[model samples]
Target chain A: MKSFNKKEFRHGLKRGLPIAMGYLPVSFTFGLMAVSGGLPIWMAVFISLSNLTSAGQFAGTNLILMGAGFLEITMTTFIINIRYMLMSLSLTQRLDKAMSLPKRMMVAFGVTDEIFSVASMEQGTLTFSFLIGLIIGPLIGWTSGTFLGALICTSLPESLSSAMGIALYAMFIAIIIPPAKKSRPVTIIILLCVGITGILKYLPLFRAISSGFRVIIASILGAGMGAWLFPIDQDVEKNNKQEGVNQCN
Target chain B: MQLERAFLAMILMALVTYIPRVLPIVIFRKEIKSKYIKSFLQYVPFAVLSSLTFPDIFSSTGNLTSAICGTLVALWLSYREKSLVVVAISAIVTVYLTGLFL
Candidate 1:
């Protein structure tokens, strides 16, 4: 509570800008989808404001639009969001131990894939202020984009919006490709994930698996294989030693 | 009743989503000891992101040709280590321009 690092926050904001921009088109599409599917504009915006998750909220909204039961929506969202468990757990390694429970809880609220990826790649431990700064822009981008898309339903040029459908995925590619190029283990993991996902998606026998589960299954298998193939013992030892020092600080 | 249903659904969805995010950060304060587990966590982001993107990316723009063009553009830019914005915007522009012909 005493240390509000404005510099770190500003750095976080700067780092988050691309994430916010990436979110605009995707959330805009979400807004358009929810409203067009007959949800109220306010409700669509509310979902974006509260959920802050891309795939989970989209799947949940689609279910609501289709009159799916509460249990179904809840389970589907939980399955899709379970990936955050890994992201959040990964983040605990980098978090400044001085960060309070309240701060961790608050920061955890914004741990989307993009934010986590950025934070994980950071050279040192993460601070609460930096995380807060990182979360705010994308949050605003996501909520406001949803509001605009809900309000401006169908008016935006079809080609432009359709083209925008690739924005989030493009950003994902941007985040992973560079790292994969440098690291052989990461390259193998990416290939494994893509191959597994393709088979699950295309093979008639596995087609019954939901998209949410597909991501979870693919991640576990891919990461599992990577870990088995390339155990990063030195990195873990260094990280643990660093965390111990941070805790003492 | 309909409004109530939507409200309930949104709240439930938000709750389910938040728990997965918060629980691990809050509960696992200590560092994981196992190198394999650490490696798995390390690789999680790339794997999750890759799984999320593929096949889905191919269908993202609603036209296979445009989507492929965009994916190629994204791969090319990102391979060169372009910023996220540059890669994304380039792919989007490529998709839009490709869509014109399709």
Candidate 2:
């Protein structure tokens, strides 16, 4: 048991390190945007700490800038983040059966795409230490980056800040490219969503809908289509592996 | 005063964000038994990722040229299975420099 616990901890930290490294630049941009958009450094940090979601934070910040109402922002965020619910659902099946409710809850809070990918890739029983490692590494990296970016924003010139802002979009391109190559459905979804968003942004009638609404509508439409086209087969190997690990324990 | 209002707004935004993050963990503690629900969950990530990527790819600026250039560069790198960091940095640099020159 002791050896098993140690191994899980080590593996968790190892997996988390790369994620933390990636999050730094991304979170830094989020912090910079938050401050530039007139939020206080503390407020920026608080938002990053509490939410820990990049795209949603960016969208929320824009909505605030656009003078969106409280209800609008809430609904927008809910729609955008509804995907996490799905991620958590998938993760529940992967979790160790012996995991306590509290531990499961804590781990679920940290279920981002990167964490989910790393966790899903693990070959054996999902341990609490592994989830802890995933959360701790990224949490530290993300918060530190936000702090650094917020502090630097005041010192930097507008032009440089704007240039650095390009990194966020760059990160998105990075995310979209890999899956797009392997999955025609994914590529088509991106193209379709982009086209629809463009049309909606330009059309006179759609101008009445807030950016938040537009995003929610676009996400629902795109996600619905993707789900219809490329369904995921639940891997029996993963379930069998978990069962085998449990029997050994 | 407006800053304070924005601060309040930021807090409100954070609260709203936390609800989605925390709710599933709290509400759906058990493994979902329904095959249909599982199937739906499986596709949610792809869809959300697509929607998130789309607007940013095009609307980073009012102009379509930078977006087009960026997309072409990104597609090329992605097709090559280039590292995400490399693809992202290359696209941004391509677009930013293009904005300056063109």
Candidate 3:
């Protein structure tokens, strides 16, 4: 607290502008989906305000719209969000180890894929001040975009609205393609993950399960298969976490 | 008006999402030295994001053609390392224009 570095804090905020801007269209779509899916405007905004997760919010909102069981919603969201654990854990490595518990708690709340990716890429240890600055812009942007999307979506024409829905997925693809092109491991893993997801989506045997569970099963099994096929040493994690986490994690 | 039900779902979802994000940051106060665990964590983001993107994207826009075209545009731009906003808006434009044809 006493050692607050304004420069790094400003640096974090400056770096965060892109993330905040990127979040607008994606969260806007989330708002559209939540409202169009029959949620109240306040509820849609509440989900974005509280959850701050893209896939988890989408899957959970669908479950809510469908009157899905509580267990189903919980399990689906937990599965969807499990990756953030990894992101936060990896972030711990770059953090200023002496960072206070209160600051740790605050910064952890902002560790989205995009924030973690950018913060991880920063040279040298990360400070709490910089993290707060980084978190503020994207946090404000995500919540506000959700609000904007919720308010704006109701007036849009159907075709335009439907077209805008693809933006999030487009962002998702934008995230993975670059790394998949550069490395053998990333390539194999992306294909494997996508294949498993496809099977869950298309296969008759899995028709009884909901899409949320399917995503859960697909991601877990796919990651497991990827880990088996391409196990990384500690160095891989240490070395690679910083090199690139751009586009969506 | 299932506002109450939606509220319940939101709270549950928030808690579930919150735990995964906070637990690792709070509990792991020290560096994680376990190689197997580190390896698993390393691939989690990629595995999760990739799975979420495919097949799911196809259904998002309600029109397969527009979705595919948008995804292609997005991939091309991101591969070239365009900013996320540029990539997203351009892909959206691709979807919108293709949407017109469809």
Q: Which numbered prediction scores highest in lDDT against the true structure?
A: 1
Backbone clash pairs for candidate 1 read none
TM-score of structure candidate 1? 0.94
Which residue ranges in model 1 land beyond 4 Å of their true spot?
A235-249
TM-score of each model, paired residue for residue: 0.94, 0.77, 0.86
lDDT of 2 by residue, B16-98 (tens): 66666567666666776654455455444545555556666565543467666777787687567665556666766777766
What ordering of candidates by lDDT runs from best to worst? 1, 3, 2
User: How far off is model 2, as Cα RMSD?
Assistant: 5.4
lDDT of 2 by residue, A196-224 (tens): 76667779988787554565577567656
Docking quality level of the chain pair in candidate 1:
medium
lDDT of 2 at A231: 49
lDDT of 1 by residue, A185-243 (tens): 88899999999999999999999999999999999999999999988886654664344
DockQ for candidate 3, please give it.
Answer: 0.65
Q: lDDT tens digits, residues B1-102, model 3?
A: 477777987999999888877887788877767665655566666676687788888777888988889888888897888766778788778888998887
Residues forming the 10-long window of minimal summed lDDT in candidate 1 chain A: A240-249
Grade the docking of candidate 3. medium
Who is ahead in DockQ, 1 or 2? 1
